[model samples]
Target: MSALLQQRSTGAARDDARLRDRLVFGDETAFIDLYERFSSLVYTIAARVTRDRRAAEDVTQEVFLAVWQRPLAFDPAKGSLRGWVAMMAHRRAVDLVRREEAHRRTTLDGRLHAEPLGHGDPVGDQVSDADAAERLGTALRALPEHLSRAVTLAYLEGRTYREVAVELGVPEGTAKSRLREGLRRLAVALQSIHAQDGEGP
Candidate 1:
């Protein structure tokens, strides 16, 4: 990891380790503090991934509930608590998208006798888009922590480069570099997926 990332990770570990201990002991106030600290970030991730306000709200609630119920599930040794919450929200949001897509497909199948499925089909287009979004999310999760944060803040949250730098406690040039490299990696991931599907980039 870069020096900046290492410093950030160390700080997060220290902060989360203390909170995790309180949570493990069933401290209600600690849980409340955790929620207050991460709720907005978690909700923002859910909202961006699911693109539905209601689903985002549901995901945000579910994430914190799970945290309270299974505090030990969070291993501070593995990652920051904030990252874990954001990841859970993203995962839940993606799951909601998949479930909704499946329901739509089932409903559409029943009406398929009236209109055959083919090119230009709206349902097919939606399915393709959802699949791409899911793949992108997977690729994003696969990125290194600093790069992923930079990309998420800049693209998902629509922050400027300077804003990302300030948020990450990094130089503006570093933020831009991370964003460039992250997007390049995402493009590669998408290309590989397309290649696997027999679709040339």
Candidate 2:
């Protein structure tokens, strides 16, 4: 039984590796093959996790789109192709849930429900967004190189820590540590800046 399992695993690895190579070279056929092979499983996992058909479909599309764009990120040596794709789908779906829940919390006023809030001043919102972006950019630039790279990749670019690890060519544990420390330092730096400006962080 162990031999059978190993053989199957090896076969899948070889198949995925070939597909990856084809994808890296911009082969449409390979992209189609990957989508055909794993789209259903990705969709099913996402649908189950998010409990939203549309979100599941969006997640599935994003997963395949990511594979299509960065084929090299999928390293067969790290794990089986099926497992990797499934995990990506799950992470993305969970991210969507977290973001949606956060939004719901912000909009909710305790247990009591009321009319949705107004859009407020669009121009003021844009100015505030711009100011925040400028402040964050300045703060990020002040961070140490390693911390800046880690935080930028993970937070700004929306890459998972594992993906950040791959991008930074560092161990996964190291990437996680750097991200945590970076976030802490960034908060301190921003708060200090806020103090200087006589505003809240």
Candidate 3:
């Protein structure tokens, strides 16, 4: 790691120690302090993985919430609290990406049913290109916020669903659902867009 990253890692370790102590003693103020201290770091990781500011923010919030809900569960002997939080953030980011990929694949599959084998003529090429772009855009926009977030993180940012789930503080199953649902929605949206563009789907 770079010097800056090293420093950050050290600071995070310290904060983790503090958090563990506070939680063990049932100090709510200490928990809040920990949230304020690490929220930015969590958000940064989430944004890097998910490639969406809003989604990253949501993930950060969820991470802190998990800490609050299960303060006593964090075992100081096993690892630092910071590491645990970071791991969670990473998982969430991965989940977001997987969901997105699933959505994209589903959309493409749907569009394939109506797509011509070849765009041989200039007019055909232009029409086909336009239809393809429209279909893609529609599919992306049709995803629910969570699903869309997963797609943006996984496909756009090149992260895995496991990372996304950790960052989002959701279960792996939830991450998969987001991807699957997003993809299904994308397929429907693509079909709709194609029909609107005068293509028989």
Worst 10 residues of 2 by lDDT: 108-117
| lDDT (Cα) of model 1 | 0.69
Candidate 1 lDDT over residue span 19-89, tens digit each: 98898899999998998788777776666555556777898899999988888898888866876887788
Q: How does each model score on TM-score? A: 0.51, 0.50, 0.44
What is the C-alpha lDDT profile of model 2 across 1-201, one tens digit per residue?
A: 356555765776788799999999999998889888887778765764465667878999999999999989989999767778988997897788667754422221111101121244211112223444457666776778888778755542445799789988999999999999988987787755544443221
Q: Write candidate 3's Cα lDDT for 95-136 as tens digits.
A: 765677554222222222123424442111232335556567
Report per-prediction Cα RMSD to one decimal.
Answer: 17.1, 18.3, 18.1
Q: Pick the candidate with the highest TM-score.
A: 1
What lDDT is reached at residue 68 by model 1? 84
Error of 1 at 9 (Å): 3.2
In order of lDDT, best first, we have 2, 1, 3
What TM-score does structure 3 among the candidates reach? 0.44
